[model samples]
Target: MRRNDHSINRAACYRSKIACLVFFAILWVAFYHAPAFAHKVTIFAWVDGDTIHTQSKFSGGKRVKGGPVAVLDSEGNELLEGKTDENGMFSFKIPQRTELKVVLKASMGHLAEWKIPAEEITGSGSESNTPETVEKASDKTSTGTGSESIKTDVEVLKPTIAGPGRKEIEEIIDASLDKKLAPIYDMLANTFDRGPGLTEIMGGIGYIIGLVGVALYFSNRRRKE
Candidate 1:
């Protein structure tokens, strides 16, 4: 029964190939489990004074290291871009005061976005209306040449006064809070990127086993034929 021997040899060859493929697949999953379950991409952002900070992570709290990040304005125009650090964190001085959208591109085609409302963005826009309004008010008041008009100009100027000590105070407060809240921010990012639960992991394992069973069943069926 050389025919029988040939069929058996063919089946053995097929089994070997399947075994090799399965072994490599399992090895890959073991080595890259973080990115294997990386479908859940999360990004979080906050403004600290004039700077916007973002943190990104994949499933299992794996930092999205070296990933590209884009900062876009309200109109979807790219403002600036940067890459995440080892800590999955990136920071940039607040771009334009418009609403900002930060997009992170993680490994394996994963993407996450975070938005900062315009009101939360500090600093003036490209044009500061305060200076223009005061200039116009001063020009108008000077034409009158009266004490009342000068007093009105003073009132106009008072509102535009860039409270000098205010910025220093804000810097101090931000520095203090930055140190205190670093861990909290990390915790929140990790919590959001926790990915699947134990139940889901077990379900995945069961699915893999089902696949292996199906492969074995077909192989045996082919041999029977």
Candidate 2:
């Protein structure tokens, strides 16, 4: 009877060890694959004049890279459809002003939207206030006598006509901005994509160990009974 009891205890200990190992292995696998199974996406967008610019990213700052973008007017009609560039940016010029809704579809079911009010597109806010400032400046210049007014007007018109069109200047500015921002974007992507941190891994392991301990405690109690 003594020998038989010893054999039974040894068997129970072996079973408990195996159960704990199996539980930890399952936990590790679940943690490792969690990110891949999750659907996490976000988007940022803005309107500049008639053009709408957008960027889409995952939780880890991984750009949608290239994906379809749809522009809809307030009436729910599709105005334009295009794809994002490598930088996760896309722009479309609208024919007229209206409240706009831009939706990005990165993949099968991932979607994000940006709603731009009509006032924003029509320049009815701070943008509309700009002309008043210019008019006030013009009035001051006009008060400087006819000759000075003529000279000032000529100087302003010369740069407007001879230097570059508004569109060209805007493109050049956008290009320079993209160049400067590229590194920052890359850094964000790298930083976020590292996935589960040390704390998360440790916490998962702790949970598995605790669960195994509980299981063994109850199991040993049952064997004693």
Candidate 3:
């Protein structure tokens, strides 16, 4: 009778240990496979013109909040507008052909305006020219007055030109904004996707440890029984 009771208790302990192990294993697996889904955005502003402040905000391929506020335009049109939080901040959702003016009101009646050229405000314009290199021939001929031909290398650099149309202008702004916000987006996406994977692995480890604890507990309990 005593041996039978001891064996029964040992069996029960083993069953409990197995149950705990399975529970932890399932939890760990669930954690490891969890989806990552969180995002946040940051906004920044640059004063492009004396009266124009270009503010852009972004998060997860969307706009954030704030604006491309124009405090004054060439026509004296005062435009003040706030951006959508869902869209991230500065948005180019306006009509392609319509010209946009932004106005901003600062503290104590301070005001500023920015006039984004139509082409520059749109994305359909040609790329602006950057400086170009001009190599002059180094061969020099005497200018006849004992002065050798002053053959020097001359580099002619071109000034950058603005985009040609509203659509192009908008495209340029978007491209510039993207360049600024790319790093932030990369970090957020990585954290959102990788965070869950790490959490799951940790949970799995915890579960395995729990399984060991359960086995030890059962063993001790069976001895007492």
| Candidate 2 residue lDDT tens string, 1-225 | 999999999999999999999999999988673222126665666555446566766766666776788888888899888888777778777645778888877665777787878765655222334566657655664576853645665588784544443334345655565567666755553554455689999999999999999999999999999
Model 3, residue 61: what's the lDDT? 35
User: Per-residue lDDT of 1-225 in model 1, one digit per residue for the tens?
Assistant: 999999999999999999999999999888874532266677899776567889887766777777889999988899999998888889999867779999987767778899888766743222323566556655664576653644565577685753323234345656777668767876676676556789999999999999999999999999999
Clash number for every model? 0, 0, 40
Best by lDDT: 1
Question: How well does each candidate superpose onto the true structure, as a TM-score?
Answer: 0.54, 0.44, 0.23
Ranking by lDDT: 1, 2, 3
lDDT of 3 by residue, 1-225 (tens): 999999999999999999999999999988784322224333333222112223432234333233334333446654445543333234333332225555543323334433556554333332332123111111112324312211121112222432133334345666677667666654543343222367889999999999999999999999999
RMSD of 1: 12.7
Best by TM-score: 1
